[model samples]
Target: MKDIAIVAYQQSDGVSDAGAVNEVELIMPVLDRTFEQARLDSAQDVDFVCSGSCDYLQGAAFAFVAGVDALGAVPPIKESHVEMDAAWALYESILKIRMGHADSALIYGFGKSSPGELPIVLSQQLDPYYLAPQWVDSISLAAMQARLMLDQGLITERDMAEVVSRSRRNARSNPHAQLAGDVSPEDVLAQETYLSPLRKADCCPVSDGASAVVIATVEKAKEWGLPYAIISGIDHRIETHNLGMRDLTDSVSTRTAAEHAGMHDGKVDVAELYAPFSHQEIILTRALGLGEETSINPSGGVLAGNLMMASGLSRIGEVFNRIVSGEAQRGVAHTTSGPCLQHNLVTVLEKA
Candidate 1:
């Protein structure tokens, strides 16, 4: 495979509701910033363009087609779309470069989740015959998983609260974060539970926003004359859909993906994990065998502000940013899809 480097990354400030901003409006500004970061002009500059989004969010078929308006494909461009998170779109772009079909590519993800019942809409992604018919919302499913962990003695409510407190504290420095500030575990524990074992503070807010990244081959990066982070390794794994069949307290798929991605090949300086819930962070940390030496979620992660489809890609961007900024020599970025961390992708990046 060809060595790939992420050259540019950009994201909008996450908001609770982008009231009047349509999907195209949410995507255009981020795209413009990404192009500028990469020292490019437009979609015409990249060999390929790919996006990640869900039509269910728009309640319309081919809703992602409307997002093309942001790209200004008037001259026509090579592009594609994925129903999954933008991290998967990044994977597709990597494959294109590896095949020598493209030298550089643009990837972005967007979501306006405030327009619909976000969790309920996500329920449709579950098994239609079993889980979907019962309308088991995402948060509720997470709560079930949390309860299982709690019962198994793997974690505690206090432990979960600490994760929330750290996320809010870490987010204080992040301009794009929707939730930030200092909050104690006691404070989070004091709040009433939104769903039995899960407090409102434990859940990621429903957010509307977008994120974009520009990646190219190492030779292409040298040609562009930009600071870049090499994607040393990347791999993804998924578990069985039946929630009962798998261990809810552990992230087996994450462990497998991390292993295959060469996460432990060298010392890890930082990690950006797409853990939407507080408890999930603990699970990922243990699964990856990350010790105190590694900084986790310096961007506050998804618990600060989840952009749905975009947050996954943002994980890779966050690690790349840290590496290029000299804060870390190497790092790992993780993205997840499906309920209860059923699917996971892991990418290891090093400074170029």
Candidate 2:
């Protein structure tokens, strides 16, 4: 409920695969740049460190432990980790600032999707005892959701192709985007489907990347004398883990999170939505009550390149970039997890 804002953000050069660089190696420069942009020194200025990343993507449990090295965390700065996306960690970091426990918070998320079978590995996020054993890859589950939407007339293949075309075209302006620039619905329709109702272009390309954001209290933000985007609201929620138990066409979690996060209070000038599958973008936009007038995914969003744990954080970074650069006065950034938008986080940001 207290005021907190993001004053700085930075990211790695997203690639399809980052084989030679280790996790710490991948994140160090990004971490340094984030602090530098914030006009703060790493050890002296940062009061807390909270990060979001996954163990599965790295193929090792406790993978985030190594990320502490990037922080140069000696003398023990306050820290925590979430198994969810880094955007979720931003929620935690801001909460820390609100609690008056820390004046400033550093948040980051990173992942390398190329190390193993990403889709196969993501199956573990399902009901482990039941659904996961069925080996339900992420794309297959998303395909089922897309089919349900089409069956009910929520969206069409043409609608999906349009989303892909617009999103990739938008990505051309984003230097960090892995895939960007012009493509047509007809050309996309010509591509082979990886899953029924979900073509390759309709889904995000796998990417290896890292992202970082700095959060500060209002007074600290002012004292730092840097550009800042105030956090208006933040919330996240989860739905039933069993995909079959819920409505595949709608994301109840997103609607609930948006309500709690107050995303509908006013018109959002821009949005950074984490829709890995094009159909999911349709569902999310509907859930958030965003119309054609709203600027969706100006930074190209996760559909251009989804780097697992880092994509959500990247959504936050995109919005922060817009606010800091005076391009948008207000925006909403959203992130999702599990199969078919099973979990969602929404945050409202405003420029001062």
Q: Which digits, one per residue and each the tens of the lDDT, describe model 1 over residues 1-352?
A: 7899999999999999999988899999999999999999999999999999988887788878999999989799999999999999999999999999999999999998998999999899999997899999999999999999999989999999999999999999989999999999999999999997999999999999999999999999999999999999999999999998999889999999999999999999999999989999999999999999999999999999999899999999999999999999999999999999999999999988
> Which residue pairs of candidate 2 clash?
none
Query: Which digits, one per residue and each the tens of the lDDT, describe model 2 over residues 24-82?
Result: 99888888898889877784578888888888887888889998888888777889999
- The predictions' CA RMSDs to the true structure, in order, are 0.8, 1.1
- Worst lDDT run of 10 residues, candidate 2, spans 39-48
TM-score result, candidate 1: 0.99
How good is model 2 by TM-score?
0.97
Q: Cα miss at 283, model 1 (Å)? A: 0.8
TM-score of each: 0.99, 0.97
Total clashes in model 1, counting residue pairs 3 or more apart in sequence or in different chains: 0
Error of 2 at 292 (Å): 2.3
Q: Residue 196 of candidate 1: its Cα lDDT?
A: 78
